[model samples]
Target: MRHLLAALFLALSTVAAAQQAPRIAVTDLAYEEQVARYFQYTRFQGKSSHRESERYADSDYSSRGSARSSGRTEIDYESISGDIVYIDRGELRKFTADIKGEMLKSGVYRVVQAKPYTAKDNEKLYDVIDRIKKGYFPNADYVLFGSITSVEPRRELNPIQGSDAISASLSMELVAEFSLIDTKTYEVKAAFSAMGEGQDMRLLKDPGQVAHLSRGKVMREVAQSLGVDVATQLEEQFNPGAARRARGDRYREETIERREERIIEYR
Candidate 1:
């Protein structure tokens, strides 16, 4: 009887251990491009002039029956003018990659590399959650889905005057917003915004040129800030240490329960 009981208990314990192990499915990570509108200003110098001329002719009857004198007058004027113009042009590239990399470092969730899809294509939020759940978790405790909600460029108009020209500079600011959804619960887990600003630089010639220079710096800052948040979130969500700690607590509980059972059996 003792042998039979021990065998049965071992089998049951094995099954329980298998059930306790977490079956995690990490679906492919998805990201949407958030193109930021950029503004820039430039100055130029040009010269123009106006001229007027008059002609008069004199004829003398006695001294010059055949002689004539002619005179001409010329007037010239020139001036310089300065202009300040505002322009909205250009775009920031490779924004999605920066966001994804930062999110991966956050360690909040297991992110898999998956196919690229847009929020428009998958309109309903639930559809995205369902897709992730199917890919990462046919049976899972949690599922995470997110998309880029908005990307807007904030411009601070700056005007500067020079001796020959007036120029305007666009102080560029890039802001990106994201929304996250939970699959099983079908709830919004989090929504937040991030921003990056580029250092002010005078683009001497044109807004387009200035935009080109400032965009890189702005995007870099945005990427850095985003990465920090992503790393923090990931750590909170899927850190191995958390799982280990939970298992440790469960083991302690099991030990206490086993001890109580043994005492009862002895009695």
Candidate 2:
């Protein structure tokens, strides 16, 4: 009789504990080709201009006889400008993973770390997150989701009109947004955004190196900030505390310092 009673109590405790935990689901950074641009185009005299040409079939119907088709070619020269939703696999992996990690560490809620996804692969957010919603984290109560609205890193190489010297510049800019929603009701609980930008200038034989560095640093730094921002917001909503706030501020300060140092070193 005692064994049976103890078993019942243990089962009830397990059930209670499970009930107290809330499941949260997160998705990858969503983006479309139109929005997935990574660089801004500035006219660099003869350097930045390029011609794009394409050919298509032009079919004509002859009133007297058979139809005739001829290949028609057109070409255009255009300068790239504005925000692009360029997808960098490494950049995105670091981003979504970090966000998931921070949410897990908060311990106030259960996070369902979602699988990898390419936003452009699916046309709709539901299409991107459907598998995770239906198969993986089906029991989640709330969903945290969003997209990479803009990703543009500036790397300019300009040759002085009068001199032979070339000036190289490195800069990174990334922006992401999120919507926290109640899964059952599909109501948006909150919306948030985070952005990161860093830049440096130096004369270099390989201007590409500067651009690469900027891309890497900006992606990682932006990811960190996004993770912290989301985690802090979640903390405030679920379990508010002065200590957590202080710790988060300290972390941000350190990140800013490191970012400054990295840029300054290139010069």
Candidate 3:
């Protein structure tokens, strides 16, 4: 009888706790490392510069029936910026800082913000778990760790010959890895990876200008979408058995038995 009462009390406590909103802390995504990683895949075109020169020397017609050449000098130069993806080269604020605010806008998780952390790109899962265990966010039940693993930006330029103008189209694809770690148990409850793409185009004298203006817009927009997806995935992970329990499937379960052979005799 005592064991039965104890089991009932524990089950009620679990149900009560599960009803509360979960506190989630999302760390910053490493921005600098991701940008450097993308540079590795960028292939630059060779002989990116073009130069032309023409020179003619004046020569008097000798005693032959030859004409004299006139003096002339001409020069031309063209330089194309190598396949460099020009983003604001300023101090790369932690992607984590920006992403955390974006995640909060989703209003899906009870997101908590902490003082900016100095954790670098090399921060590991164990290190994150330790921070949470040390009461980094006292109310947080889970800490989300994320980093940008890959980014690919594609740019297309088409010159409209009529008006001396160029049309530029830019697209960026980003892939990131996110982990949700439980504070108490220090177990990675979920690992979620998602790819998001953003695109923008512009018509300007220089095709390269399109990317300069559009890169920030695309990445900023992608970050918002990325935040929502991560939050939704973590919510599902935190409630793995909620769907089954809600359907009255788990509530009716009896003693565990070999499911392959045993059938419920008294359903």
> Best candidate, lDDT-wise?
2
The model with the greatest TM-score is 3
Stronger candidate by TM-score (1 vs 3): 3
Give the winner by lDDT: 2 or 3: 2
Q: Give the TM-score of candidate 3.
A: 0.51
TM-score, every prediction: 0.39, 0.48, 0.51
Candidate 1 lDDT over residue span 1-267, tens digit each: 445554555566545544553332322323344345555455555555555555555666433224345555554555545554443222233444555565444333434344333345333333556566545345544443333434555555454566432243444444544445454665655555555454434544554543334666666765666556544554554455456546655665676667678978999
Instruction: Give residue 208's lDDT in candidate 1 (0 to 100).
Output: 50
Report the C-alpha lDDT of model 3 over 45-115, residue by residue, as the tens digit. 43333445555555576333334445544455444443444332122243455456655554444677643
Question: Clash totals for all models, in order?
Answer: 10, 7, 2
Better of 1 and 3 by lDDT: 3
Q: List the residue pairs that clash in candidate 3.
A: 28-96, 29-96
Give the Cα error of residue 25 in candidate 1, in Å: 10
lDDT for position 153 in model 3: 90
Q: What Cα-based lDDT does every candidate model obtain?
A: 0.48, 0.62, 0.60
**In model 2, what is the error at residue 40, expressed in angstroms?**
26
